[model samples]
Target: MSSNRNDLDRARAAWRWRGQQRPDFAVTPGPGQESVWDYPRPPAYVPDSRHVSVYAGDTLLADTHCAMRVLETGSPPTFYLPPESVDMAQLTPSDRRTFCEWKGRAEYFHVTDSSGRRIDNALWRYPDAFDDAAPIAGWFACYPSQLRCFVDGEAVRAQAGGYYGGWITDELVGPFKGEPGTGHW
Candidate 1:
């Protein structure tokens, strides 16, 4: 309802505050490494076959062998999993929604465990992605900070700052966008 929308708006405003200097956390990408600074502006979706899994403490919430990774400038890669690979029964639709210029409207989901523990609005998806991002339609992406997210058995560090959901791992180098003073990046 309006309250949820307002909350979502407030959250976005807090995270998207403008002003900054791009920091120097970007490292020279070595063999088998990717520098987030080198990512493209409109973002690019690359099919990823690496196994992806999400857990709420000891409870398995999602597991997938197929995923799509979005690489955007100044941000770590974000992996999107097909809905079939997630435990849809444990997720309830949330009233919150957000707009992504390239991805269209993103609907939020609250994750819950059978025991009733829940993480509010921690997952999201673009039911109708813009043409440039259509590859991710019907896919879901989680905030690693809200749950344990893994790629090929490696736990991913959550991208700092709550607004953008990107997965950070040894394979990537930053100053990523979510950190302090990166609003303008």
Candidate 2:
């Protein structure tokens, strides 16, 4: 386990874009917009007071004016809603688990709508987050691809792939990391 952890640490250290410099392909943010490239590598836990909401079809799954945005370089922000704002009954633990060197292990959840429609692994949380990521310990982040998500009344577009959970709002500009051929980014 220690060997695997060390290997993960090494891989995390090897990332090319750590937000010190933006790649040529990165989009420059217009007035109120933010460039994902400007975010940090270890990610910043930004407290966002904007109204964020998630819906599984027509059923509301989560809603909050207080949320945390995990801002990482090369990716759009992933909004994490506090547990108190989420409808816990709609989520069930999923078998899928993933590790983030910066945040520690993440556990997935399957979100189900009132109509019984289920979106597997539609949400995730870091129950035992690393020291730096401790603020989001019980917060949940949903995939916009699997559910409808909004930030301050603006609809969110899912970051270009199935794996990444970044929520792209109109105020954010990016040649985000999850797109095809961007595996190296």
Q: Which prediction has the highest lDDT against the true structure?
A: 2
User: Where does candidate 2 have its weakest 10-residue lDDT segment?
Assistant: 1-10
Instruction: Please list the C-alpha lDDT of all candidates, in the order they appear.
Output: 0.83, 0.90
Task: Kindly report which residue stretches of model 2 are placed more than 4 angstroms away from their true locations once superposed.
Answer: 1-5
The numbered model that scores best in TM-score is 2
The regions of model 1 sitting more than 4 angstroms off are 1-25
Encode model 1's per-residue lDDT on 1-185: one tens digit a residue. 23255654554355331223333555678899888877776678999999899997778999988999998878899999998999998899999998876577899999997679989998999998878889998899999999999999999999999999999999987778877878757
Candidate 1, residue 81: Cα displacement in angstroms equals 0.3
- Model 2 error, position 101 (Å): 1.0
- Model 2 over residues 81-124: C-alpha lDDT tens digits? 99999999998999998888788889999988999998999999
lDDT score of residue 49 within candidate 2: 100
